[model samples]
Target: MSRALGIYIHVPFCKQKCVYCDFYSLPRREDQMDAYAAALRSQLFETDFSGCEADTVYFGGGTPSYLGPRRLAALLEAVFAACPIAPGAEITLEANPDSAGDPDALSALRRAGFNRVSLGMQSADDGELKSIGRVHTMAQVRSAVEAARKAGFDNLSLDLIYGLPGQDLPRWRKNLSA
Candidate 1:
């Protein structure tokens, strides 16, 4: 029997870089997206995975959502065409609230076979978010979550940062509750 595998697709594009981020990401380079997507698809087709089935397909990076729904859908289509995916596979996309809060986009992504969404919710405090150089606000996070749910995503997760500058126990608790 073939073994199950987890496939991770990285999108190294971001609207802007966070102050504390050390990852290799480019800011506001939308022109390169099409070429990048094509290269990624080519790589997928060139790779040999004859005896394995993908159980999870995770799109992570500068912010997968920054790639936009159409590009993401195209990439996902390529993934399906190139690999043997297991039934009920978990297809997740890592998104920032500012980019992924659109209900129409979320719906399109859901229709494109993405069943899970992981949102970057750095902090509930606007000041903390700003301090971290996050482009999204706490209200955007809330809206994104609501939009994701409305778009038929039942599996939703959030990313949080603790010990941020000026972050205290009370603040952390507030973030948790938020």
Candidate 2:
């Protein structure tokens, strides 16, 4: 029997760099996105998946949602065409609070064969979020969660970061409780 594999596609584009992060991420330049998409497509096309099937497809890092809806759809389309994904494959996209907040964008993702969404919550407290240079508010996270639900996403996931300059154990507990 052949073993099934999982796929992780890294999208190295960010709206802005986080102060603590040193990951290699290119700023989203309008002129460069199309080329990025093309390179991604070319790479996907050139890869051989003859004996293995993909059981899960994860679009991760700098921020997959930074590509927005249509571009993201195109990426998904390419992946689906190039790889043999299982019938019930877990397709996940990592998105920041501000980017995944749009209902239409979520809808587009759903249509593009994504079944899961991992949101970058950062922190529940607005102050904690700001201390890390996150532009979105907790309110935006709430809205994004709501929007994800409305867009028919049941397997929603949230990611949080802890241990900041002013983050105490008590505050961490409070953040989790909220």
Candidate 3:
């Protein structure tokens, strides 16, 4: 019998680089999006997944949401074509609030087989977010959550950062509560 595998797709592009990020990623390279998508799809289609079934597919990286719905959908389509996905598979996309807080885009992603979203909330406090070079604000986070819910995403997660350079206990607590 074949084994069920958890697939992780890495997107190495971002709108801008974060000060504290050490990940190997390209920032401010929107021009390469189409080329990157095409290359990724070619790679996915050429991979050998002979006896494996994808039970979970996670799209993570510099900010998967930066790719937008159409590009993401195309990549996901390639994944579907190349692999045998199990029924009710968990397909997750790691998104940034700024780029993903749109009802229409979220709906498109949902229709493209993304069942879960991990939003990079970082911090609810705008100051902390700026300190870390995150472009999204608390308001955007809220909007993203609402949009995700409206798009029929039941499985949603948030990514938070604590203990920044000037972050105090009170501020951290506020982040936890907000």
Candidate 4:
């Protein structure tokens, strides 16, 4: 039996760097987006993906949605042209609720073949989100989830983190229970 292959695409663009985050991400440069997309396409074309089929394609980083629709579509086109993603494959994109919660953004993602979205919910408590330099509120996360659902995405994932300031055991338990 042949093993399934997965594509991991890193989008190193963030609105602002988080103190807790140590990932490789930089600020978004609108002027460089096209060049970066071209570079990615060139690299994908150069890769030797002959027999192995891609069962999953994940776009992770500071925030994938920061690229907006057009650039992301171009990248997706390159992925489709260079590698064969199996039918019904999981195409995931990591996004922050602040930017990706809107209906238009979610719809654009769905149209571009993103079947799943990993939203960085961080915590259910708004204070925790604020303390972590996250601009979006928990309400925004809920709204984003609803928007994603409305956008026809059935496979939705939320990223939650523990050990924030002022978080007691009971508070954590309450957070989990909510």
Candidate 5:
């Protein structure tokens, strides 16, 4: 019996660095994208997966969607070329709504084989969004979600933060309701 494995890719870029974020990320640098993509391809090629059959490929990080559609497509191509991903593999990408304000990016991601998308919505209230320094507004988050659905992504997840400075149960419930 062959053991199924998982592949995880980390994209370390964001449109803007958040105040409370402590992840590996840098502000968007268009010049660095191509070089970073090449490095990622090289890394995938160098990695040995001789006995592993990947059943899942997760693109995570400071903001995987920060790479946009083109880079993400290139990276996915390189990964597929490097390994044999199982049929019906769960390919997921983490995104920040602010970074993914463009609907075309989400469409391209779905076309490139990502079946799942995780969005960092953080909060549903305008004040909370501002307090957390999230670049996107609550309206933007809703729009992003709608865009993802329109892009044919049925498996979508949103990330919310609890235990925030002023977040009480009511706020949390309201967020949940939204």
Candidate 6:
């Protein structure tokens, strides 16, 4: 199979930054969101996607889903305008469970053309989540997953981290089983 080009958009905002994470992200600033979106649009428009058809478009960063559905849609539109995204192209958005507020938001994101939603669940254990400075509880992760599924997103993926401080194989297995 031939390799295809992938486009990545960074959304540098999060509800709260995890202690283990060193990505480019800040707490949500309402005033800066619009400006950031505009800047992203301009950057997308000015860039060239010559000689490449993007087979995948990934929104990754501190938290792409933090931008909410309307802004995410606008960003997707700008990306589509910039290049020809292959039919059935895998478009994935990285989201934190703590940040996924309402089911309607996920539905709106689906309407915006995102077929895949990747949630940063990190761990299924509440203690592990707290130890990692993740603002979400295990219940929140379950809720987020249910919300995503209800929003018609079947291609959902969850991120998990192992080998954390004081974590053991048994704990990892339990987490994985959960």
Residue-level lDDT tens digits of model 2 in 1-178:
5569999998888787777677777765656777998899899999998878899999987888988888889988988899888889999999988888888879888988999999988889888788787878989999999999999999999888878788899988877876
**Every model: Cα RMSD to truth:** 0.8, 1.2, 1.0, 1.6, 1.3, 1.8
75-140: candidate 6 lDDT, tens digit per residue: 999999998888899999898886675789999888888999998988888888889898889898
Off by over 4 Å in 3: none
* Candidates 4 and 5 compared by lDDT, better number: 5
C-alpha lDDT (0 to 100) for residue 92 of candidate 6: 94
The stretch of ten residues in a row with the least summed lDDT in candidate 4 is 27-36
Give the Cα error of residue 75 in candidate 6, in Å: 0.3
How do the candidates rank by TM-score, highest first?
1, 3, 2, 6, 5, 4
Per-residue accuracy of model 5 over 1-178 as CA lDDT, tens digit each = 5579999998887777777898887776767877888899999999988877789999988788878798999899888989888999999989888776666878888898999999999889989888877888888888889999988899999999987888999999999998
Candidate 3 to truth, TM: 0.96
Candidate 4 residue lDDT tens string, 1-178: 3457999988888788777888987874667767777899899999988887899999998788888878887798899999988998899989898877778878887898889999988888888888898878888888888888989889999887878888888878766775
For candidate 1, write residues 1-178 as lDDT tens digits. 9899999999999999999888789899999999999999999999998999999999999998999999999999999999999999999999999998888999999999999999999899999999989999999999999999999999999999999987899999999999
Task: Give the TM-score of each candidate.
Answer: 0.98, 0.95, 0.96, 0.92, 0.94, 0.94
lDDT values of the candidates? 0.95, 0.87, 0.93, 0.85, 0.87, 0.87
Residue 37 of model 4 has an lDDT of 74
TM-score of candidate 6 against the unseen true structure: 0.94
Candidate with top lDDT is: 1
The count of residue-pair clashes in candidate 3 stands at 0
Please report the TM-score between candidate 4 and the true structure. 0.92
Candidate 4 regions exceeding 4 Å error are 1-3
Whole-model alpha-carbon lDDT for candidate 1: 0.95
> Who is ahead in TM-score, 4 or 5?
5
What residue runs in model 1 are displaced by over 4 Å at the alpha carbon?
A: none
- Give residue 97's error in model 6 in angstroms: 1.1
